[model samples]
Target: MSKTVTVEVGLGDRAYDILIGSGLIARAGETISARLPGTRVAIVTDENVAASHLEALKSGLESGGVAVAATIALPAGEKTKGFAFLQEVVDAVLGARLERRDAVVALGGGVIGDLAGFAAGIVRRGMDFVQIPTSLLAQVDSSVGGKTGINSARGKNLIGVFHQPKLVLADSGVLDTLPIREFRAGYAELAKYGLIDRPDFFAWLEKNWREVFEGGDARIEAIAEACRAKADVVARDEFETGDRALLNLGHTFGHALEAATAYDGARLVHGEGVAIGMVLAHRFSARLNLASPDDAVRVEAHLKAVGLPTRIADIPGEMPGADKLLDYITQDKKVSRGALTFILTRGIGQSFIAKDVPSSEVLAFLRDSLG
Candidate 1:
């Protein structure tokens, strides 16, 4: 029952708003139709979430008089963010005979949103898509920006497009059904907002961990507020020209770990990888004298307080070899001339984009963190 925060992505004719609030899912059809006006709708979801809230979502859209053709469900996982599955989902939408006037809905976490959004981007030159994020990670981060693409063997999100959602519906009520482990994983991304640039926000998160985890309305607003912050940045720079890169605060290292871990096959979750990567970025920054060691400690402490991973050892399974960091991290988009352009924190609230971080130094710090 809080105010609905709006982040307008100023794309001229394609500009859209991200409305964040609780109970918003109930009104999804009306809001989505207001922006997306396509008569035919395809609800793309994963098996996990489809079983729980698919009916409610369908009813919402149906009540708004939107005709839903088919509901496509993909298997849930980080592995789903790749070509093979995306092709099938696209096929499903096509089989439904959706035309240029129709739209698709992504109703799940990052995996579904990314894959479905990719389908919306390429199938028939372009179609509208909506994000009904069931997970905190997607609700606050991935589902907002128009960055949609699948992973490649070369790296993560290597094959993607910037297909913005017509509207993003984050139903906070969905959080209660999420497993505690999954909730913790999403919290990593939530903490990342502060680690990247909002140090005071990080401190605030540390003080209110219980309310956030146990489900407090104010904390829900905080998540929406963070989404608004990111939405504003994405609105200004959708294609990551300048300010949008700020959103990738811990993503460079986090992505490298995900690649190393092979998209978390019995290894780590996306947010967990991000948790480890953020700490490494700061530590490597300190090793190069570009960032302070105290900053790294505080980052680690905050991650640990939430029971999130902050080191290599925290990875539950055998992760990628630190000795192979150059090979793994070198695939990042930020890399050039075999050097990783690390996103490092100068202090708790200050971060800077630093390039020329030696691959060797990054490897050494990775080794130290694992111990």
Candidate 2:
């Protein structure tokens, strides 16, 4: 039997539990039914995940005596988080006659979690939802936060809401089915926690990452640690009014890179983009004399060793110039009153929000980075 780790996100009445283990998906229905008895559920998933784990989820729900009101499987990929599919999910849930008290089950990775959570938030003015996040990325990062939304042509996650889930089941067993690239991508988010504040955790990962990949107690520990770190931050700042923003250590530049690639999974996945972005953030900080250049080199080396892209040139195909990339950065949600707010680091585990960053300085950095 695999070990089960539960991390709680404390938001008083809005609090929920994240269950991380090997077989949680097979047990998801019991967990949900216990917390939300007699509620019908609508399972929202992407085609890729549906092909692999949807039946297990349905069987689990049935075994737990929970009625599944509907199952909607949309096309998979980052592009799925958009206005069009958001409406499709909302329409599917409402069309199935799921009430406000019934639940929407997000049964995939970060994209499904965000899209379905958004649907649950809006359908009939808010319905309860459960996140059965199948991917390591969703299991560790996106599943814990209440933030949900789709991307826009302007920027990523520009249109979203704060909608917490009732419970999250992160099944490590499902990761066995993930492609190597996808799993590596998710590892970037897991490593980000260590970069943000837990230097010890980062060092631990550097030593035990192979064990983490091999799957065992180490993987569970890494996921639980990441979830615990995020849960603590979410408990303190649910709305990202302050400390929660630190969770987005690599996201600012990462999102811009996603936009530059038009969110193409072939060119760059979210985690890969984040890996590059994190290296950029550290390098940029060093350029500002806020951190040692060695810190940037160390960060880059770690991510590259993990097989993540750590530089702008690592992206495939032709990309727009630094100016065009900066245009997308201007549209990032982190912009506050026309000034950029970035999570800059003084060292490997010393990140802080740098507010009102000069656009001219950012432009110069981009130019240098692109060269």
- Candidate 1 per-residue lDDT, tens place, 19-137, comes to 66667777888887776675679999988898888988999999987898988887877778888898888898999999876888899998889899999999998888888899988
Q: Pick the candidate with the highest lDDT.
A: 2
Pairs clashing in candidate 1? 149-160
Candidate 1: 10-residue stretch with minimal lDDT: 1-10
lDDT digits (tens) for residues 243-351 of candidate 2? 9999999999998998899888889999998999999999999999999999899888888888889999999999999899899898887888887899999998899
lDDT of the candidates, in the order given? 0.79, 0.92
Off by over 4 Å in 1: 1-3, 319-321
What TM-score do all the candidates reach, one by one? 0.92, 0.97
Residue 212 CA displacement from its true place in model 1, Å: 1.5
